[model samples]
Target: MSFLRQRKTTSQIPLYTGLQIQTSSSAVPIQIVYGANKIAPNVIWTGGFSYTTEKTKAGKGGGSISGYDYRCGFALGLCEGPINAVGGVWSGQSITYLWNLGLGLFYGSMPQTPWGYLTASFPGQDLAYGGLAYVATASFDLGSSPSLPSLSFDVHGLLVGTGLINSWDANPALVIQDLLTNPQYGVGFPAASIDSTTLLGGSGGSSYQAYCTAAHLALSPVLANQEAASSILSRWLQLTNTAAVWSGGKLKFITYGDAPLTQSGVSFIPNVTPIYDLADDDFVISDDADPVEVVRSDPFTAKNWVTLETLDRNNWYDATPVQVWDQNAIELYGLHMDSSITAHEICEPSIGRISAQLLLQRSLYVRNTYQFKLGFEYCLLEPMDLVAISDVGLGMNKFPVRIVSIEEDGSGILSLTAEDFTGGAATAAAYPVQAGSNTALDHGVSPSPVNQVIIFEPPPDLTNGVAEVWIAISGGLAPIYKLADGTTGES
Candidate 1:
């Protein structure tokens, strides 16, 4: 384990997928999603990636015509498996298009029908991207804009109850565990390599899954194609202060904090009890370095105010920002501010407010930083494990510390860095009461192709040779009538 100075493995992931850029490349990989995510599909079939421009007469006379209306046609690859369904299609980041407007969705069904655009463009090619969810659009109107708009989708990849846990889709721990262990469309880690006991919140500790559900911090993050697994894992860990280990050839996952004291109220285990009590004699004797160095967090690096921004489920998943501050700390520290963005699918104000409060409190507490070294026998100690330090030189007695970093060297020594910790410091208050507007309606569903048409050319005296057509429909939605011909009609 001396090779523990490992290089980061998740450098490829983007910070937040508030926008998923569409890519067109031969070597680009398709995504394998678990649970739900907002994804930007890869362009797998660009054969129909053409456009149309229309310039119509302004006010029934020629010459001074209206600007051109550009329409684009393309096919996109979403992810593996026959997903539950696809929701709205977002243009760039904000504008969302109705499903029936020239957009077609296939839920990665086996033996998928060849896409209409594909079948029409290349008559003999029957490449259906079988067993892969995708979207095909025959025409997307740009309405006086020449450039094609960027596109993304809201997709629910897998939501079946496969006995992993009750409502696994809503439990991030269960969802992540399933993703890593499932042989299909997952990283496919071997069963034996996983330590399921701890990951499922077993033993004396509370489950991470329960905390997420109670905190309203469940995730709907996009795991786009070509993104490394380590990136996704790292993101989840950072969001919840979680840690994953591969000790003894068995992988395990642990969330740093204990379970919420109250499922819905503002409560969290910021720091656990110390696992080991260490003295100067327990540290590895070094000729060139000090074994223990007491540390107080750098005040210059401290923050009294924290703002958290993430999706607000109560507001149609709109981006919401919430700020919390330590009034006394601001008076003492002059208002140092810090901001963070998370991808969790939050639904309550208390969730965001409580999380921000935690950050602010931790900043105000200014946890200690302790640097030390220990022999290989102490290699089992992982980051986040609380330790009690008793030092004669500093006259410190059982001082609590939280490990934040660990590095191993060739000399079979563990280099560690820790900060002062108290479980109470990071526990703050929040209310489940919502503080936002009502949510927008869900996206429109794709309607069937409008095939029943009745054309009437009236007589000369009948309405002055104008053909007036009227139809009645019932229990129906606004028709999704964007067709391949680039013409639109309403009933």
Candidate 2:
């Protein structure tokens, strides 16, 4: 006996409403009504959804939901207002008008103070529940026809926990460790388990420990716990030469020297053969037609030089300048000041070097952005996930890229923005090689090997009847040095 196999049919799924708004003042959730009513046929809820993340610079995510509220003759009985009254209020039976007037549970003024959550979920999708969300703003349209009422909300991702309102003076790493291990901080998972890949232990572990001891963070009136953690983690990464990523429901602070993600390491691939077929209408591609490649002119410079200046606990000042310039860039565009950044929290020479390394790496600029849209059946990719794109026609043949952003339209389409993984390699190559003690300067300062030497005559005003020349060295430590009176010393 032979069994017959059934083929699955593909159909577009319509989005069903699964939104609930609960305020701190109310015990029950507010039921949002959609569509027209008998007395107010024009008043209808169009649609609204929010998009938020903790990955962005704002360190918070927010989105708005909007709909139409038109006033027609058939709805005038429901929209009639009091005459000759100051701040005249509407006594309409229209649901939109009622919502606009802050009537019922849809209190428009509730969000002015701290309110409750706006939870969302998809009925049939796995892991469809959204994080707790705070309603930031809600406004109703008051214009003529087809007015839209929108409610803007922010997701309670990493920054919704109790804030550190007091001043904290301690080792940056210890503070971070305390926050990561504390449940009140809302960073670590249950039982305060951080990912093992964290940089607290590694070949660079000793250096990280030194960084913890050397740098002191004085944080006063810090924001939410997540934000404070993010701030401290950011400083620690800069000082300890590492990176932090929130993945798998845990926070992991890894070093930049870690191996890149390969095809074997990715959770899953989307739009690939055997898994997905673009030829079979599985995905659509959109490339940036006029992508920027390089910086060719002024005001568009990279950080070739970084000066780290800090004061110790005893108020002793220490300044260390590191230069990592591209000779090709200088020959092509001349010397442009990339960054003269200052960090007061850095105290150790090793931390200063790490900070310099980070700044130097970021000085290498390259921009190439691409976007793709995949069907809902395809697995969703989060920001910073590594994936390979294979498009022969567009010269993206199995090229690995990092996801920059992801968006899901209500129509079951997932959109993603991916870019070339140029992770600090451009300027990494420009890092100066260590030199021997014999190459040290007469003033007991040993500078890195110079890549390019530039000499220029001083302007007449500053010379004061003396012949003066300015010397600029590129690609080594200390790109700019002043020498005077034929002395071979840096001034």
Candidate 3:
């Protein structure tokens, strides 16, 4: 077998590098060395080789050769072979001894027949139970050859077909967590994680023209569909809980809308047949969380209801039954859709241009950590670098520490940065940051960074009182800020 190592074989043989394997007589040992190619810095294991031995038997009429003869062979490396062609690197790590790299390919497999791919690897690897072997293997057909692949493809295609792809960027994510946690990956847009960016024409440019044009061309139809659905939600919200009688019990809600409340409304309103069927009107639950026990009111006063205000009547329609237990807590029961709700049930609507107030309580927000000054007056913000900051509850901590960072990138794109003062991972919370210049908190991501720099690559050309920062921390700890000397009315 060693002979093959010395005298290489033909170019047709496939040899794996970056690994060393010793075969018992039947095959020769191989040594893989990386960093041999200068032109291709990522190229690993050049001049690597493999060998094999063959046993030959003598014919019955053999004279001099009565026994079997053995032969060994080897192969040489080509500068353009697959091994030396594919490039990759583990930044900062120099001598990387790769144990196994299951044929370098997408979705973990080697390309077979250019369109199809195959790969072998052990996923549930364990040494005690002989885990150092190929455990779970996966292969995929990339191209449309077999006609029908699977449901995942169709579902993915449908989602991509929708403008939902614009929800994220195409910057190749390194891992699932990167796709989930990285804010830049999704431009801080809600549902952008599960969404795709490639569908956005590959150029997620930070320009009013770019996004506006893209929105005009791409999101219009999607938004139209969304508007239609939102209209339906608004209509549904206008419909009373007459479907069922209202009673004190475990409410059963069903979302007839395509999307859930998280998308455009709050929570999905189960198809609740209020025990006492009353002609449904725009009922507002004082408590957004647990609407039960909380009083429900008409969104439009009887005076306004008579006029039948023709609002968007499609996208912003929302109503729910809420009971406030305290200034910070509430119990929500019944929910209704509004014209503002989107088609996607889980996708939070873009609170792009709505006004807001500390609904439950009214107190001034005074920052404690640092203060800053913009002009002519004692800077309210300490470091001028900080534009606006929010004090949010970061679960397990006493008070909500400042988080998200907002910055103007001079290019019209808004960039936001979040910090983890809780000593947890910076990714403990996931929310959108692709907030436009609208002061309204509607379209922005919920449970977002309370205090972080939001840099607009290009300064937004619009303004409103609601275009403020919002952060949703884990454990439902929504951060709130108050003046340092402000007294707590109630704990």
Whole-model lDDT, candidate 3?
0.22
Q: Candidate 2 regions off by >4 Å?
A: 1-175, 182-229, 238-243, 258-282, 285-301, 310-319, 377-380, 423-491
For TM-score, candidate 2 versus 3, the one ahead is 2
Cα misplacement distance, residue 434 of candidate 3 (Å): 4.9
- Expressed as tens digits, the lDDT of each residue in 1-491 for candidate 1 is 56868776533322221222346766756666555556677776543333333445546555342344455566778888788777677776564654656777888888778876667667776587788888777666655554457777767676532212222234567767867887666787787888776566522345565455444455555455566778878777555545787667877666545434544332333336688999988888678666687667667678877877865644545678877777876776687888565645333355567656656776677457789888888888977678898888788788888787889999888988888776566445545546577645567955544445555555668677776665533444456576679987653
lDDT of 2 by residue, 285-317 (tens): 347532212123232355455555532211122
TM-score of each: 0.63, 0.38, 0.16
Better of 1 and 2 by lDDT: 1
In model 2, state the lDDT of residue 76: 10
Evaluation by lDDT, superior candidate among 1 and 3: 1
lDDT accuracy of residue 254 in candidate 1 = 62
Q: Evaluated with TM-score, which candidate comes out highest?
A: 1
How do these models rank on TM-score, best leading?
1, 2, 3
The superposed Cα distance between candidate 1 and the true structure at residue 221, in angstroms, equals: 1.1
